[model samples]
Target: NLAALMRIKRRELLLILLVASQFGCIALGLVWGASWLHKWLAQSFELRALAEAHATTQQVAVRLTRDGTKNFEPGTAGWERLQSLCERTTVPYDGHLWALRRDTGALICHPNLHEDPSLLRYSLGRLPIVSSGRAPTLLEAINDAEANDEEIASGTIIVDGALQLASAVSLPGTNTVLLILQPYAHIAQAATDFIAPLEQIGWIFSFGVVGATTVLTVVLINRYEDTLAQSNAELERKVQRRTQSLLSTRNAVIFALAKLAESRDKDTGEHLGRIRSYVTILAGELARSHKEITHQYVAELAIASSLHDVGKVGIPDSVLLKPSRLTAAERRAMQLHTQLGAECLASIQKQLGDDDFLELAREIAYSHHEHWDGSGYPCGLQGRQIPLPARIVALADVYDALTSARPYKRPMSHAAAREWIASRYGSQFDPEVVEAFIGREAEFRRISEARFGSAASECDDSESTADSPANEEAIAAIAAGI
Candidate 1:
């Protein structure tokens, strides 16, 4: 089933099939060719054996003729001497050399008579005859040899339970024939030895072809897999680049919307930018001490902090633009801006699904004004009840307001603003967030000065307030105004 599920292209599959077919054909060819070669070698070896036996018989006939016994009478001493000469001749390759009485098919003598004395007792006619399917009998073989002008006649026979190749040759000038018998098993073994090197060569060729094919196939598959891996890596990189581009565009849109809300108060110059930088710095520093403050959290917090004042867009222009401190009802109306901004962002988040940026913005907008002691605003959320992003933005918001020029007051110096924030720790802000702000106060001041010019080092007398409910409301109003 896994093989069935594998996705091989038609071209690749076809190439594999073709290669396998070629290997099969090559293997079959090697087997068939080896068989043919073996048969050829066997036939050639048999022919050479027969020719050597015939030559040995001819040499014996020549030796007898040189002894002046070629035309000797049958029962004469010279004839007996010629028979003794034939019996004394040494045969090569364990062959049997003997003579036969041609006219009556009687045996004369043999070189191996001592090993097989029965051969001297029978004439060719009396010897046991054996046939191998369409082959001639010994008598018929002798007749064939005589008819063929006394040329050597070769045939195979079973003698004493062993197969033998018998070659018969007529004597040159006598009524006698020379026969040489070699064991068929011995000739067969010689033929096998003769072709052993050739068989080895065939095996090596077969193995080489198969091994080369396997190596080539493996190399090709490896190359194909490497190419596929590179393609997947390239595709992943392209997707990441496109995703980053889309996120950049979305962030640009979010910032533009936040800036639109900030535009309601002309005095809020670069307020959103300063808040982003401050929240980023505070969250970055807090990340070192808190596992929850991750790089992603810090980045989202920076973008979300800009929307802390987005709710002010819902306030009436009269109350929002008032140069003096607001009445209780006017301040209450302005406070509803927090809920308005949160609701607006929540609706957008529902349409966009659960986006991290929009979710953080909604939380910061609704809860940044909430206090650490449950006394700060629309909801009396205490301590950690306030979202981390909201608590972080709370300190950043108050610090920026104290240091920037507002419609109701001149800018306070960096030292005065720092003192004001330090005094409110644990009551107006999360202690950890306050600590992070204090530790990185210099970076915060740098960001503030970079956006709005450095504030004069003088504190205004009217900006200082006593710790009372009336003064707290005024301070809360000023902190939320930005």
Candidate 2:
């Protein structure tokens, strides 16, 4: 039960993991895809806010350069006025970089000159020269933003030992560019902050959903398993009771069969074994030709056939063992033994109350000696009228009798016995039954040897002989083999 429970839990865990993985993958995909879309949308908002600062830079450059502002002498008042215009812009203090330059690419005035040695001398060669429109990045993300070219475009750099996004600007009336470096720590932190809430919610939703579903599924499976376990336990108990009854029934059948054999042959050492072995072989042969019944029926047929001569218990021993020919009355008395076997089986049936047992016994005791030509005694069942089980046992009994010497006759050789069986085909035996036997001659020979041969074979037939002295082996004891 522990192992079974573990297996069930493992299976459930695997299913839960699969479901969780599916949901998790979907949620992660959705969150990341939305984040990309959001960044695209936010770029438009940034462009609007920075538009004026970009126009101011570009317009002033056009005004100064187009009117020959470059010809203004040094220390000229107009140069000072232009420089004031450059410094007087309302751009964010850190958001814009202001610088004035000549067409020769020489810097005229720059903001925060002493901030750093390279700050004023920052080169513009690598920056794209957009025509007063912004781009997403100078390294090229969005290049066709016509109006945006006048505003900031993005670029990265290490300034003052810190990573920054540096946007370059063309100075008024000059090819020189101004570099504005914004530290990226704030932007990167802001991006992380934006996704943090979603991460928290994602974990909470995923863990909660998975945990709840796993618990619910486990509870339902537990209920089903508990019910199955209870049902199987009850079934096991019922099977135990039935098994006890069957064991008792089996024992009774064994006792009766042994008693029948014991009453017949006193010297037979393994009589039960010999008779059951013969019937089993014949029954097995019959099983192959008859395809309708389950293979299990052969075992029942063997058991029932073992008790065929049980009726001999009712016959007087004087007639049953007579060394000489019996009178007509004695013959009749001997035939009555068949009825006695049937009667005994009927009595057992009443006690056991089993229909199958009665049917098998009826076939064995009543029709084992019945012939194909209606010459056999008792009911004189002929041809197909004789049950296949009885016919098989009949052949086996006669074969064994012919080979094993009895008080009435010396044992015949196997060849002689075979010849006698062949001759008796239609009169004393069913023609079809005889044919089946002839066809299964090798098997029949094997069965005979197994039944009455040696330890070297299936049975210890060689240890027993008809000439062996009587040892008082009971009929019931020997019949048990059947």
Candidate 3:
């Protein structure tokens, strides 16, 4: 018994050491990852700042040169515009643009100089330039560049006691140099904001893993011989639980992202939920006839259907949320959502490795607008050229849009929507999917009524009569990708 206890104690000591090593490794990894991420972010910001400065400087030069101005005369429109551009602070990064006379280092345009006219006489060269190499002053650099006949120069500059990334270019036919300055502190702050959440998540994950492992090891040591079989069973259950937890987390994140994209349009009103429900009905009905529409396929299709309009997030608010019929150009732009959504999902799939669900989502997002008669906006995929999931989602999406109210139009009655689907059977929809819809018409009506109130709520909610001209016009608008 003593020997057995000693063995258990030794095992506990080993487990503790293992946990300590894991904790050390996790800590080191977190620190290294954070440092690398910050460095990368800083570099990206620096490049962006330099590019903006260079572009703005060239633009000022062009404007000045275009007006046939030999010098930045104080009263000229070109001079005023240059001053305005310099005074305008850049967003998110908080940078500045200013101009200086190359010959005397006279401040020509700056927010501070504009605000305090006295500062206009102050020389930019006197501000001091500092870098890792203890770089010479801007005046020295400008003199050096003039000596070399160079048009542009870059270095670190100190302004208002803050170190900034600086880009400077000589204005053509003028003794002026345009300078753009971006503070390093702002870049570091942005990088910190971006990386803080990741750091927090890493700490939580590491702590959870370490704590769980320690507790499990203690439990095993306490009941090794008596509960060895039970412990093995418990471990299997734990693994299954963890796997299920991961799946739930993934699904939640996906649905939340889809919902976020859908929320941009105010009239969508439970659009995702209704689409998911509608797809389930259609896919389930079709599953009876198509062998590929298995249980797993139906489940995935329902979730994937919610992402059918995820590409709408990339569309401009003017086009996406417009309350009227789209112009030809706007319609074309709206149609690009298919490509955009497909690309978005494709990028995610590439990062996460191959995922069957994401592949299905991408397929549906890309081709849900396709018509059966080879007339879809994006690919014009006809018949089986369109994936089964996309076809299922297409019917579901149209039906939901018809039944749901939008700012541009009233909702169609269930009977009208049903007849509309029936009319588009061969040309716009898969005949098999249409047949499935026909078989499950009752279920569709039930879901619509439950989610969106009774179809009879509309004054023209008749089952047999032809749709009015106004309703047809609204249908046309919907068909235009409203």
Candidate 4:
């Protein structure tokens, strides 16, 4: 259930949890170990202080006995001698040394006799005597020592509310014990000094471990996310490549279909190719200033322009192939080609649903023959009323028609065609489109010559090329005027 709740993979989730648990255990162990170490160190320090104090007191007791002042009798020469001897003796650990009466538990002589008389009075008045516990008082330790026939006794006690450690040794052949007192504060200080560095080290080590773990976790997560992002980017690139391949295949099929229709009109040599190139040049120039004419639109327009005259396929061969000028009836029939081509593309688009390239093709096929002044055929769309693709194809088609040789007439030179189109700027052509064409006339001449050779010379009466032999009779009758 826990695994199902997590969105991550089970293996990754388990790995994260395991790492977290390990760190948690390590932190818990550090805390528990540090506490145990502190307690152990404190107990050891207390025991060590007691042992050292007992040994030093025994040495003091030995020295007193050797001096023959074992019996401490006040106002006696022996007591005075004992006092003088104690004053001369060097105490260890800067401690206070005194003699206590075993029977009364009274402090008899101390080294602070003259310096602090009241302190000696206080010590002699209420010397603490604990009977039980691990830290017995000085009197209790001495009693136990006497019963056990021990020479030394040591324990902790409270004197005037200050904790102190006391050690006593019975002076041989005397009713006295030599006692040494040291403040518990001194022992506590030693223990604190010993444990302080360890505590600091423990804390530093714990923080270092946690900081390192945090840094490692952050680095690992970043690396994983980067890897995931790279994988997603690579997947998108592959999908784009596949999509581009499919689009290329669809474009090739469209161009082939347009070429099939052109095959019916033998006089149009490389007509689709020149028209597509001319449209590209004009659209590219317009793109520099026209916001609507983007690079993508220009590219789609180039391909769609090839199908501009595809409706010619629907015309009867007799009218469409007529060598001479068409009659009004045949002209009207020829005009129907525009509507027929639009309907053909519209049907394809209906099957395929809305498509950018096919929609543009239908618009161009239907409206390319329309005039800017509304004098053209089909729907008679004028000016901006015609779609931009259709407007672009219109100029490209007229340019190709004027420059290329036809079944009836000679081809016009690039200069003559340019002037002819420019002459009808607002009527037969869009003023803006004619201006764009004027700027790129040199490119137009290059494309025309590359596709259909140099423009045909002015037609000479005796040098006219013959039409197909199958239509010679109709052509000879039509050629009578020439």
Candidate 5:
């Protein structure tokens, strides 16, 4: 239960982390968008400021020329008028208005001329361009504008020892150049002021959406998992019940079919039961030494072993119930029972499609009589060439036939049967199966005695004294008796 709970907790944690990561990506995307927007706004504001500065310069030029003569002497009426106009006309941002001689780039009027007396000696043409790359200086731009008869020239220039944007226009009929200049930092500040508040609002909105989405997603995941677990548990219980019912029905059908074949002969006497029990004992013992034999293998073999002699139903009563040894023809006819049983099981398997019990039954029915030395059956299958299941059932079948009374011969004691099986190992039966039989011989006796009760005890009584070593002649006598 703790492990299951831990697994659920782990899944929830992973989902939550995935949600958090998605939000992080969204936040990153928003930041990238905001950065692009900030740059766009900055460029827009810078362009607007430059355009306004150029227009103001043009108007100042028109106004200056309206007075008719360029009498720019300091303290004169024309000079005062020029200074008043320069001081009154404002540029966008923290900008200034100044006038320069168009032909020579000499400073004529400036807001700072009175404050700094050296400003009068400042020449736009003589000032060193403070820049990092090749660009048009203010004096060069103004000269180009005058030569081209253009009204405006605007570019970056140094003012008061700092970088500033300058827009200049030459008076139409005079040597005066009215210029508007503003610092670059002012344009960037204006753009930032426009976008910062909006970014703050967007961040708050995104966080709210992300938080709400995470909560809703977690709740849905929990509810869905609970419903799915309940459905799965109920389905599992139903499947288990159905599987058990199918197994019971299958085993009953197999046992009934085996009984049908056993009913044709009266002397066999619970032979199928003893065969199934013997196979189970041998399979269980072999499983300890054989990696291929498993508990399922043992159980399936126990069920399938009963069908080994089912073909006896097809044999005529003359051959099947004969009270004495048969001729070679009748013996061959008797061996045909294995082929008949295999064909019967094969036909059934075809109808049943793929099934483990039917498959095992068919193999054992066909090959159970096959000898390890390739001498005993419908097919002369050699050692280890026989299927393992058939090999196991072969040993089991022989041991049961030897210990049980038959119309042809009296039953041998458990010791005699075991000795015969051990002697035939590697020649008539698989050595490994014989070893397993030897290891579980006591269980074999118990199953045999239990099946026949006092009748089996009476059979063992006659052989108890004769359980000594049997020579080749004695072994031949026993074989002839069978």
Candidate 6:
């Protein structure tokens, strides 16, 4: 009982209290900010959908009514019957229809109003056939002319406590204004029904991220528990707790971010981790040789390296994962990934409030493909003009990619990858990173030999990652294997 009590008791309360104390301000800020953000995004989405629906529905209505009237030949008996039939259909069909008379500017029909007949007359009286309102009127939305006819447009409105989207237009040379209101209940049911399932998916995703964060927080906290334990102030303990919470949030956020890139490409989170390792090794080698680079710079290179392919998200799969080499046009399109990656970094940075992380990420994303000699795109920065992290990751990313086989290409050996890096040292890659590779030849050899192995040089286009050394061990066990 005592054991159970201890397990259930004071520590959790203290932890909660401590977390609330340290991160209360931040936690409150985060939650409040998230709530506002969700609402803003939803409203914006709803508005856009509403606007599109309005335009489409109006255009379609105008085209149909105008064309239908012109096609009605007055000499034929079929024309009268067709006109009558068209008139009948104009009334709201189960709240999805409105019939306008072509000969007279009159509201001719509505759903279920046909039976009473008297009620239709009253509706026609109150309903203005045309309005002087400054806002877009039905006429503007559903424009039907002889040569250029637009389609009937649909829009959302609330009528008699019911929500509906109406589509209406008129025929050319006719006074009739055709209108239809798709009831809000049906539209909402159709629109919102899919969201519940999606929300569930989102909920599971959110929880999964939270769960992963919890594990990471526990690991991080446990590793620094001794240090955390040394903190004397209740507030400091709270701050530490909050720090862990925020840190956990950060990890979750990063994982979610990686997932975004991963969703576009089948080889996601693993791909990011693999590239990060390559970036780290290459950066470590570079830092030792280049006085311009610092150890912190190397670490930043590793962290930001996960985002090198982040631009791939903006690239369509048809272009990105093509089995064969891209055409000049397609290749140019693919090159846009660098810019897209920068945009993504900028968006996240904007959201994250501009920090060193985002700053480094943006730099790496934009300039990683830049050449040492200004031949690389998007911008042709030469020599030290490129950011160190970008230059460092550029070499690392390509090296790992060459050694790691893909669907379309075979793996190159570490030696072969090195040669490739060497070949392009000044043209494709930073000369400094290349010199660093040569000067710290032993470290380079060790990192290569240890990570890829001595036989990696034997790997060719036929090689597969299934047995490659480019695949890295998990961070937790990197020490064990190394």
What lDDT tens digits, residue by residue, belong to model 6 across residues 1-482? 99657744655665566455545554555566555655565445455444554554455456556545544344354345444554455222144344554544244544454465553442321232222233344444454322255344445544556655555655445555555555545544444554556555655665565556556665775587557556656668788779869866875676567667767865332557666666666677666657866877666566677777678788888976665545667778878888998998898888879688778888988888887778777887888889888887777666555555455444456565566568776777777777776655555444444544645555544335423443322111111110
Best by TM-score: 3
lDDT of 5: 0.79
lDDT for residue 408 in candidate 1, whole number 0-100: 57
lDDT of 1 by residue, 374-472 (tens): 987878899888988899898888888877766455666576678778888897778898899889998987776565442342333444532445555
Residue-level lDDT of model 3, residues 51-103, one tens digit each, is 77777777767766776766565777767877777677453367777788877
Q: Flag the better candidate by lDDT, 2 or 5.
A: 5
Candidates by lDDT, descending order: 3, 5, 1, 4, 2, 6
Can you write out model 2's per-residue Cα lDDT over 65-103, one digit (the tens) per residue?
666654433367655655565455544324444452423
Q: Quantify how close model 2 is to the true structure by its C-alpha RMSD in Å.
A: 25.1
How would you order the candidates by TM-score, starting with the best?
Answer: 3, 1, 5, 4, 6, 2
Would you list the C-alpha lDDT of every candidate in the order shown?
0.76, 0.59, 0.81, 0.73, 0.79, 0.58
Better of 3 and 4 by TM-score: 3
- Alpha-carbon lDDT of model 4: 0.73
Q: How close is candidate 1 to the true structure, as a TM-score?
A: 0.48
Quote the positional error of residue 146 for candidate 2 in Å: 99
Q: What's model 4's TM-score?
A: 0.46
lDDT of 4 by residue, 360-476 (tens): 999999988778888776877798998878888888887787666665655656766676688789986788888899998889988875644422333222233323453343332
User: Candidate 4 or 5, higher TM-score?
Assistant: 5
Name the regions of candidate 3 deviating beyond 4 angstroms. Answer: 1-239, 451-470, 480-482
Error of 4 at 350 (Å): 0.7
Cα TM-score per model: 0.48, 0.43, 0.51, 0.46, 0.48, 0.44
Give the range of the ten consecutive residues with the poorest summed lDDT in model 5: 473-482
Off by over 4 Å in 6: 1-241, 266-270, 289-297, 439-482
* lDDT tens digits by residue: candidate 5, 238-350: 99989989988988988898898888888778888888888988888878878978898889889998898888879888987776556778777877888899999999989
